[model samples]
Target chain A: MKMTKLAALAAATMLAGMPAAWAEGVKVGMITTLSGGGAGLGIDARDGFMLAVKLAGRDDLDVVIEDDQRKPEIAVQLADKMIQSEKVDVLTGIIWSNLAMAVVPAAVAQGKFYLSVNAAPSALAGKGCNPNYFSVSYQNDNLHEAAGAYLAKAGFKKPFILAPNYPAGKDSLTGMKRFYTGELAGEVYTKLGQTDYAAEIAQIRASGADSVFFFLPGGMGISFMKQYADSGVNLPVVGPAFSFDQGILGAVGQAALGVKNTSQWSKDIDNAANKAFVDGFQAEYGRLPSLYAAQGFDTANLLISAMNKADVKDADAFRAALKEADFPSVRGKFSFASNNHPIQDIYVREVVMEGDVITNKIVDTAMTDHANAYVDACKM
Target chain B: MSALLLIEQILNGLQSGVMLFLMAAGLTLVFGVMGLINLAHGSLYMVGAFAAAGAAAATGSFVVALVAALAAAAAAGALIEMLVIRRLYERDHLDQVLATFALILILSEGTRWLFGSFPLYLDVPDWLSGSVTLPGGIQYPLYRLAIIVVGLAVAAGLFGLISRTRLGIRIRAGEADREMIAALGVDISKLYTMVFALGAALAGLAGALVGAIQSVQVGMGEPVLILAFVVIVIGGIGSIKGAFIGALLVGLTETLGGVLLPQLFGLFMDPSAATTVGASLASMAIYILMAVVLIWRPSGLFGVRA
Candidate 1:
């Protein structure tokens, strides 16, 4: 009788372990600028994605994260490791455009889904748009296009444009000029990743232009705004999403006030989802959420929503679901285009001192469901 | 460009130059007096900014923050000298470089661990927050003007101390002949520590002052540090006066080149082409300046050939 009882217990234990052993865990890998000058944005993106993943509570999915250190080589290495060794099904979270260009093609070659949380270069939006590639964030041109729309409406007769001398910077100018039908007074390009802007500002003051447009992101943006304010140039300065985000407001401070820009979502957006995300983020990180964080949060949720649609079993089906635009975005009613980039309303915002913090409040809607002019160039 | 615009550009150059001087002064002093090359100098600058930001946030007084910045940087410098730097003093420049580079990694990571990878903001004093009118109808930032004043004052103080005081005499003597000073019964270690502290204090002051205008955060000092390196290289390492001049030259060249080059190119080419070529070349201007200086004066403008 004792032997019979032992056999029965062993059989039951085996029965319970069979299904557990058969379950395959899905792997997702993320690489980001987790150190150096751009670390703040990368950290925000990381946190937002993590929060979404935690909220989803997926038993079958496991996520791995790595710091690219803002180096394309390092990002590429991480991508290779994720694809070859880790066998990750999805790769995401790129903050620098150069780094994104390096990693995205690698993921595409492997037939893995790529979700970009930030760094929307126009090349990816237009000529290089891939079926496996999707930008959960705005196109590099979207915000600039919005600025252009605002400039057109403002009836600025002659405008001077400025940007860092790089591919994305050129795209910003091209994006702006597309919508803005004004006399081009002049244009100046500062060095990419430049820390000083006095000379450029001096030239701008001298140019006799009616207004100025610029697209500088991260540290470059902060430093330029400070110097521009210092130079006391009376011409109104304008740019896009990154130029006046919460990530840099503290440094720019009062200098940022009266500066207008374009963005899809601001901290002051009157939406329940955004309100909850902002409050929760501040409570967790002790700062306001930038657009980077909003997109990061949305990216994770969108991924989860697509996974649910495809039941996490079919990668092709999941990609199709993601491309179908079936998620409620924190930014009021948004969707993805056929090219896998966002199609949404972009708002013109002016930086103002709101209570203890500096934030952007929506002044007007600049563009709606705006397909980029370069869309025809994209075969997709 | 109009004459007014040129004048405005010059002022901008001056502002950039002064900021560079603030960084170079401390670095040059440390190298000259201590006979030690410190790669972690930038780390101290970062520490000072972080210290100031923390203190200012807590007390809501910029004055206290400035004081705390000095104290924190000095304490950190003295501690480093006592623990790590003292060991590397007898080592070669390569060893010193490697050790200090390691210190940068440790300090940067430690700062991030403490600050949690977010930038802290430092507010300019209400009194120094606006723009002041310049001679050419140019309004420059008041905070920047204050930086110029502080930098000049420090330069004056340093010169006075080196020429007029006993401690300065000892420091100069030690720099010339360390063994002789020790043979004469001077507490050489104490003197070295004091010099180190003094250099650290200058760096701290710079960090604290600049923090008000920029974000006070981890890795903030690296850019300034690189510029300082360029300054000392052009000025001749170990020469304070040379450092000041070299810094000014670099600052002006960078600022003015950024503005003038594009326009100059614009005169010949289309706006897009001019902007691209001009901006790229302008960014390279200072490095080119350094190379030219090195070609003419291999030992640096003020460097005494060993």
Candidate 2:
């Protein structure tokens, strides 16, 4: 009689559009770089993500976090584990573009939802766009394109441009050129992970450019800014916000002050959602929220918003619910473009001294309702 | 690039060469006095930088930071040399490499645990913050010029210590024949510890100095360590003089290759394509140099024949 009852319940669960499983909640797999050089960004994002999940107070939301060690092969292995054995319904929290590229395509193809907190690489935003994939952050080139627009507006005619010799780096320069209406003084690709920039500094000085633009993220940015400050060329510098993010600004110190960088969000966005996020994040983590942290928070809240409307087991319903994006975003207004990447305002922020703290403040809006250039290429 | 710009780049190369020398000097010394290959030398360098950053944060004195770096790294070096490395002398190179590599992981993890994953701020001193206009109208950073001077001075001092002092004679003797030195009433074990501490101190000093310009963070030492190994290999592992020359060669090849390679390619290819091809090639230039050096003299520039 017990066996027949169990079979009857299973049949009922299958027939009623999975109403019983909604109470059990969804399992989320978060793979991010939690160690090595990029650990600061990942740690902040993780903290912000967990904070939002905690605030939801949903005991049913189960999140499993893993460290990728900022390596691509390790990320692939971890993704395989998350999909095959752990049986996660949703996958998120990848910080680097290369790792996201490696894991996202496969995860979404396997019928699991992949919500990106950071690293919205162009390939996934365009031709590789999948219905199961949703990017909560701006596409990788969004900030760079904004920076290019701002550089032209600020009247930097002969700007020297450079980035690491990699796919994203190439994309960064290309995006910048799309909106930059100037004759480039020089465009040089430096070795990726090359810390010493004295040679590059000398090249910049010799290039006779009116200003400088570069897209070196993380430690590369810190090293370059500090070295550039000492190099004495002192041209006006502009780039994307990755280099000047909150987690890194402290290490760069006063050297980063007065530099203009483009971003999709800043702490001082002047909205109820953003203010709450900034305060809540600081109260929870005891550290300032970075751009990535905001993304993590938004991603978690979006998942929470979707969960309210549909059972995760019902793929069509869940996806449609996610597409609604009913959650109040910290970026004032947020929406998904047809490609599933974000369409939002990109702001120009100047690094400033908030007493002893180094941080950014919004100075200008570079683009309003800026959908990425590759959105048209995305059939999905 | 103009003649003035070229001169500035050459200076940059020289400055980088001297910093690499500081790292290679310690590695070469440790290898020469003891046949143990230490992959953990980079850990000691990292210890120095973290120690300096922590010290600098507390006292706001660059001098205190430097002193703290030297002391902390030397202490750590002595402690490890006694506890782990003393037992490794009897082991083979592979065993020593494995053990030292384990030490690297331990030290790196320990550092991460203590400092967290954020980089510490260690800026150049106020006096050394700006550029100095050198002869021929080249504007160079004062800190880098100071590094060049200090490195050359340290090189001279090391030569004096090795050739002139009684302890130096004993070190050279120990390098030549450790068993003979042990038999001849010399405290061979004590000598080894002193040598190791000395090497560690130099590495610490380098860390503190370069930390001012670079991001002082965990794993900062690993990249520099690779270059140092390349230098020691090119210079002949056991010879300090050779290490210095080898570092300069590597530094110059790397710096000049980055600047000139693109220009060379630009003559035939489009400017953008030239830059792409040139950068890819330039990244390989130093390794190519190492290969050529190895082909001519397998042992190294100053390495004694095996």
Candidate 3:
């Protein structure tokens, strides 16, 4: 009985030692991909967000994170857990479109402010856009549309379209077609997570097209590029920012060289804001920054600015302040449109090799105030 | 739709078939020799890529990186066999699978811990960096051609070693009858370790070679591992020949389906809708092929009849 009493007293003493405000710290829950094939994106978002929190040194804010494991169902469940059990005031960090779609609606329904750090699904940008939700990233269609517009300006007469079979893939094709008024030799759709591209490459080779446009990210992109190069197909490859980002550039190597894509930011961008971001990220993480990292960094700034705007003495005020456009972003000057998506410029970039580095260099600006066509379709 | 396109697609199919063979070879050998279904086999592939990246970074030599990757993967497999796998060897398949599944979790997390949850890049060697022209005016990647050559060479070497070498004979004996082999003075545990190491080395080599062509990050191997399992299942778990054929079939069907299905749909439907339907169907094609094969040959093609 004496030992039990001593143990209880010890526990009480330890609890008392912690700052009283630690208990009242603004609780923000973050969910991102943490395992399986899509883990790289999740890891970056999670680590970047935590790093931002540390850099801010705001001990007044507490963060709880969950790994969604790339499943939409798991994401929904985790969002509920963060809201009800953890009692977090805000939610952030969704890397995939499906998971974002699944979790955002739930967060908005609960009137909890959702600050999306990554995914920019067009549905969320336009009509399906929510007042309670805000994006720190560009709309999903912006980059793809930028690629289409750039290719059209390049005067590529015959273009071939290819992407994985999914909603995002469809959006990419639609986004590209919106700007490129060329004779599409063909539009080919491949399986999501596919690793081979021989048949498609062969088809493209024989089709006599001038260029091939595809939207294969991750392992799928690597496999296809390798096969395309191996088959000796001479057509230049074109893609959206994601199809050949820093995440998989190493894997694609020389195959990705000379490929053109549209993007928001690249490590090679020469602006002062970009140089600081690139140098700081490399010094801290020992590698180049992906667009995901840029987006994550932007999210941190957005959230803090909102906090200052609403003078977040309480969680409710913090939520309301974030809903009001309150942040100065590194991606030029940007504000949330009526639909809660960022109205910003999309840049068309070209992939090149600089010594050992494989990176994209922005060559042209493609679009501004780029909103998805489906925005009006979404009545919300 | 022209004959030239058809011919080109066939070649594409063949190339894909070969790539799958590389993944399936190690999986089938390990399964055949030791009735263990190592779900973590893919994790080993990932380890190989990281090892290659680390070695190349240190030495500035791609060949050294390749060698180190294979050696490290083999060592890891042997170590794992000694520490965790040997006990499970006598257990049921479900238990073996569960243990290996646990190993995958540990390995993936351990990798993240060491690598700091970031991806590392591997460069293609300068020698094989360019594209080559084929007879049909087809342009092919030199590295890909090298991969095919290397894969075939390894296949030949594996066949020769299994058929002629003393260690291979012992392995064959162990596979045929573990009890008799043990009675004949073979160190069954040592043999198992060597066989497992050999299989791991092959997987490592595949991972290292392919890493240049794909992202080398955590959990990168799981998808490939699943496809390899499917290949071995179709090929007959214990039959290397079956694995080779099974992998090729899957690769060709999947590639061709992605290309042909869209064109077929375009003949009737709008190009946009056709693309959606085609891509969805293409992804399903290989699984459907696997199902059809299983229905026709429950024991798998070339599998020894139970």
Candidate 4:
């Protein structure tokens, strides 16, 4: 143990000597949903992260990517392999909340730094927070809370809401209700992975809601939007950007037109850092970068900033450097909250068709410097 | 709470039931005729949806898309029947299940390789888009009504084919005694292939129809497959009529249970906790129905005892 501590100190000293130079090999293990329903999000995140690393021309950053298949068990297995066998100093790139919940705790407990690209579960933001864990993405509730705040400000009274029945789903509603002051017309939890939303749509229609807020991510959102469109009860649907993200807007087609969603980043954010990142991403990937990509890009740049300031082998120094958050973020106003999740401006974006290509444009700022409700719960 | 809402929810149930029938019909026929438990039937459904999406994108015609789905799923089914599934016929149910499960993984990965991981675009055609007021003054999506019409028509046609056609008689005979039918100079293998392809085409049709509204992606079929299995189990493993009735029952129960249980619980419990509890119970309603049916009949609602 003494020898190991001495070796670690020596390694830290050696790594510390290289200031802003090559930080001597910081291995990043990315276990993300690469081949399943959530693959688009993970792919964009991975590509965005790699793009940042490429743009920075960092030789020390070695990324080992693996597919989690959106299964928690698979994510746990991959995290174990990445931590124990690969000995990666940093872990990142999990899209879904359940997978993040399964992997993050154990990984952080073992003293490896985890930089989250997306999926900020509220538990991690609250009492379960770890100093070693840093989420470049907003808290799980941030976008939902932003949506609720926007709706309340817009005076959408008697709003009906729905979400899938899962941990993230529950969190989404709770977050929305936190800022939403209006009386709920109806609240329903559809089964997770439920493709059929007819019952829910009918309920929404009958409930006499002035607006609808649903947190159905992935194909569930697509189905609900399409079905809601055809149901002839267009009560102004809104949610977080998961449903309206660039990755899936095309599949949703005209159904999502004019629908507002909340996010920390958009393609039309109009900042130097954001414009450069967007242009560079389009040039590199041949597609519009989703918010997931933005999160990933921010995460990589954050790591670069931290590496420039301190050696990764020195835990306290590296943690402080990460907390500094000196990186140029595509979101423009990104900074780590007290619990390491993002404390940033959330923007409301409206889905618009630009020459037959469905995408979103920034409409309004929903919330400014939105720190989560769970920040007080976080002791660390 | 309102009668109109109840009617609309019933309609929703019927629409979902029709889609399940399309899937369960094929599953039942394949299992009944071949004595095969095919866990990979859902993969065939996925293949159908992908084929449809691809064809729709290329041709800009829903008809072409549907035809592509039918042909692709049937062809895939025939190929598997000839190559892999034929060997598993003599094997136990466990072996068949394991083999078909493997087929599901292979087909899903192969689909991802072909189409990439992103969900493909498939929407309801222009003519079928929008809502119509039912006789009871309930507004319902026209596409769902179309699905019901199409499903019932298919069921009628299928029933006619089974009862009237010589092919249907042979299928029934083979199910009764395979070796005996083979000894009686029947082309058993060819018949099996044809039946498998037909069942696959039905699943494919269902996939294409549902894919327009839901998503066209890898692993999309697995969830539907589970529901379809539940449908067949409730309806009776080999009985088409049972599958139809069972599907409708499950769909109605699912839809109504999901909508009503929360409200029912709200009468005695807090609304939020009621919703939480009700949604959980609602998901299990169909499985509970299955269990009750199994206990009552010992072989499903319409299943024949050996």
Candidate 5:
């Protein structure tokens, strides 16, 4: 009985010694795709975000992770559960734009802060933008626009553009055309989750396009690249970073090498925060950090910075602190636009084989201090 | 499109059709012989891909990988039949579906545990990595042509086995009358196990071949599995010839529809709008064909009237 009492006293003392910011215990609910086809992206994001929280070593912060299963309805249900039963102060980590569209508005409207680690849907950047919601990742169009800028600068006049037939796919093409001042030889929208690209490749070969721009993400990208390489169509390929990220690059292998992609972050970025993130991530996960991981790590640090400045319980004060964006972002200079979307530089990255491992190296800046076209449409 | 491009697209369609036939053949055979609905067939496909990928990565031999895929899928099928599937033979299709669905969850999670979340890489052999020129000067991937040849060879081999071999005779007899075959001193359970394993090996072969071209990861088999089911339904369940024909039809329709529909729509609407509509309709083309076939003949093209 005496030993039990002594142990309880010791535990109480240890708890009291923790930082005061953790006293109330900031509860963060993370809902991301943890299974299905796109599981790699979510897994990386979760690992990177958790790594940041672990490094911070804050006893007061509590995180609850849930799998969205890449389903919009399921994400909405999980968000509802997190907000009502879990009573989480913040919600973050949605990987797909469709799920984000379903979950974010309602969650933010419920007076909970939402820090998106990825998936900045155009709707959220426009009239649907909410003050309580902030995007740590690029707008859906930003990277595509960067790719377009790179292609235009390279003086490609006739390019074949392709994407999966979905909302994001349409946005990608629109983003590319926004910056591209050249004629499109062809614009094809393949079925989402299409595995075989033989028919499309045949058309591409026939179209007389000097270059190709595609936005097939995850397994779709892998299939397209392998088939493209095997088909021996030697046109220069450019795409958004979603396809060429570290998570799926190995599957793509030498086929992806020398292909240019656009992104906001790369492992080879010259910055102290990025160096720490890349090194720490590789040390922890034994793999190079992808752009998704960088976004997730930055998201956690951003929340921690806000938590340090103001208590989450004080809603207005916390909101103001978060708006200040006082954190060492992995991207080096991340700032929130008026609509709470990120305004930062997007870079062109070329996939290069370092020894045997396929990864990306930053080549050039495509866009500087870039903000989404929908920012002005946002009332807030 | 030019004539060369059209010819290439047709070849692509034929290639995809043949791959689908490889998957559909086993499924149709299993369903026709066993009267069992096995949703876990896709899991077996995934198993084959992972086994091949793991083997190729370790040994750097495509032949070893192919053999490993076949052995792994066959072994998994036999084990499942002995442990869990044998008991379900007397149960209804609903029970079989539920049990097999549980198996899918178990297999997927188990695979994730064994192979981490990231997709595994499987390289095409150097000899099969480049393109081959066709009669019309259109370049097609040699690997895809190889897949087509392999699939057709398997189809012929399956035909020979069923028509010429004693085991095939037993399998056909068992499918016709299980009790009669058992009473005739044939080992019914053993035959069932063999058939299941054979089907699994075929599925595995398809998985391994496709894995070389696409990402080999968990849940990779589901899309193919769905298409295989469609093929079997269109071809007529339990009919290998039907599966072959149905698979080819589905493949041709899917590829041609994707290309032709957009141009057809472009005559009326803007190119972007036409593409959106065309792609959407193209995805539904195979299903639409299935529905049309079913409407015309409820039992499918080759399926017998019950």
Candidate 6:
């Protein structure tokens, strides 16, 4: 009787483990900036992605996460590990453009699908486009262009523009210029990662500009906003969503109030899908989701939707299924452009106090069905 | 630019110089007396910022925050010295480097675990919140001017402590010959601990002071740490006076270069191209200045030949 009971227990354990082994379910490797200066952005993305996967209630799926530490070399090494050792079917989650540039091209070349939650560099959108690469996030310049359009519509003249002296910084200014018709009063490029902006603030005060457009991200943005507020430079301030995201808004505090920014997503986006996501995310993480978090959630849902249609082992079918973009997106209506970047409306958001908590509220739509400048360059 | 703008720029340079001196002074003293290359000094700066931010949030008093920063950093320095760093003093520079680098990773991760990833807020006190006008009709933040004044006062106090006190004599003696000082009945270990704590306190004070203007977050110390090392190298390693002069030079060069380089380039090129070129050059100016100083004096401006 004892032997029979032990055999039954063994059989039950084997039955429980058998399906996961037989299905050969999808394995995903996520590499993101998880520690150091801009860690808040990456942490939010990671939490959002994990929350979506948990909500799916699938036990067969296996996900591996690694911290890139915001370094391109480290990201490359992690990508190699994920591809060669872990044998992940899909790779995603890089926050910085430089790291994305390093990891995405090489990972996609190895025939693994790369879904970008953030860091949509123009290079990959255009000449470097690949069939396996899809960006759920906006192209790096999309929101900046929207801001430019908003400024133009608002009749703001004599704008001063500034960004860090790097590729993305230059890209941001160029994107703004693409839509803004007014002559810039002054254009300055501060040092990347510069903490002190007193000299630059003095310049801005001296320059007779009526408005300021800046693209300083992460800690640089925090420092700039604080100093700008203290400097009493009361001219209207505008920026892309990078600086004004939900994660850093508290750190910016009262300094960011009334500032106008542009993004493809906001918590107050009036849609059922968005309401569910915003409510569910806050319930799960105990914090409001940032734009990066929204992108991450969408990326996870996109993968899950494709997996329902085709097995990742069938690469062609899987790729086609992903391009279909059949999943419900939090952004209301999201479709993939020919280049695999999102073609959706971008909105202007104002930083406002929502009962002692600093957050963004959607004011107006900046652009509808906006496409990137590099789409024409994409052969895929 | 107008003369008033240039004057304001100069003041900005001075303010930056004073802050850099606060960091460089402690670093130079530590290297000078201990002959220990502490790559983890930046971690202490981070600790100070975190402590100050936490204290200020809890107490709502800037004075309490300042005290907490110094005490936390000094205690942390002493504890680290007792546990990990003491074992490393007799080791070679390579081992020291590897150990301290490990400490940086451990401390950064530990801080993250305790504080989470978000940056903390540190506001300037209400009394120091606004700007004051100068003689040239230039507006400068009063808090920044306070930083300049406080930093200079600390420099003076440090100078007096090192040159005119009994503890200062013992420190100099230890620097000159550790064994001889020990033989003269000084508790060398205790003295070492005190000196390390003092240096750490100075670094913490600098971090806490600067935390008001900058985001008080993990990894905030690293950029300042690198600049501080450059200042010490330019001023001559192990020389406080050298660190001060070097820091001022770097600060002035960095601030002025950002303003002037583009204007200078505009003379020969288009305004857009000139701005781009000038900004790039200005970023490189401080390192270039350091390289020039090294070429002129390989041991640095005040460094003694080994």
Give the candidate number with the greatest DockQ: 4
What digit string (tens of lDDT, one per residue) describes model 6 on residues A60-150? 6788999999999999999999999999999999999999999999999999999999999999999999999999998999999999999
True C-alpha contacts between chains kept, each model in order: 0.52, 0.73, 0.61, 0.76, 0.76, 0.63
User: Tens digits of per-residue lDDT for model 3 on A274-348?
Assistant: 666677777788877788888877787677656655543455666566656555445665666667777777777
Q: Give the TM-score of candidate 5.
A: 0.96
Q: List the candidates' TM-scores in order.
A: 0.92, 0.95, 0.89, 0.96, 0.96, 0.96
Residue B215, candidate 4: alpha-carbon lDDT:
85
Across A18-70, the per-residue lDDT of candidate 5 in tens digits comes to 65555486999999988766788898999999989888887688999999989
lDDT of 2: 0.90
Q: Look at candidate 3 and tell me the lDDT of residue A360.
A: 85
> Model 6 chain A: which ten-residue window has the lowest total lDDT?
A14-23
Candidate 6, pairs of clashing residues: none
**Backbone clashes under 3 angstroms, per model:** 0, 0, 11, 0, 0, 0
* Model 5 chain A worst lDDT run, 10 consecutive residues: A16-25
Q: RMSD for all candidates, in order, please.
A: 4.1, 4.3, 6.2, 5.0, 2.9, 3.4
Cα lDDT of model 4 by residue, A1-380, tens digit? 99999999999976665456344758899998888667888999999999999998777789999999989999999999999999999999998888899999999999999999998888888999999999899888889999999999998999999999998999999999999977999999999999999999888888888999999999899888888888899789889999999888878889889999999899998889899899999999898899889989999999999988888888899999999999999888777788888888999999998987999998899999888888899997
* Position A16, candidate 4: lDDT: 61
> Candidates' lDDT values, in order?
0.82, 0.90, 0.78, 0.91, 0.91, 0.90
Each model's DockQ? Answer: 0.47, 0.78, 0.38, 0.79, 0.71, 0.68
Q: Could you tell me how far off, in angstroms, the CA of residue B53 lies in candidate 2 after the best superposition?
A: 1.0
lDDT of 4 by residue, B198-239 (tens): 999999999999999988888999998999999999888888
Which structure is stronger by TM-score: 3 or 4? 4
What local lDDT score does residue A84 receive in model 4, on the 0 to 100 scale?
A: 90
- Backbone clashes in model 2, listed as residue pairs: none
A180, model 5: CA deviation in Å? 1.3
Interface RMSD of 5: 1.0
* lDDT value, residue A52 of candidate 1: 72
Per-residue error (Å), model 6, residue B68: 0.8
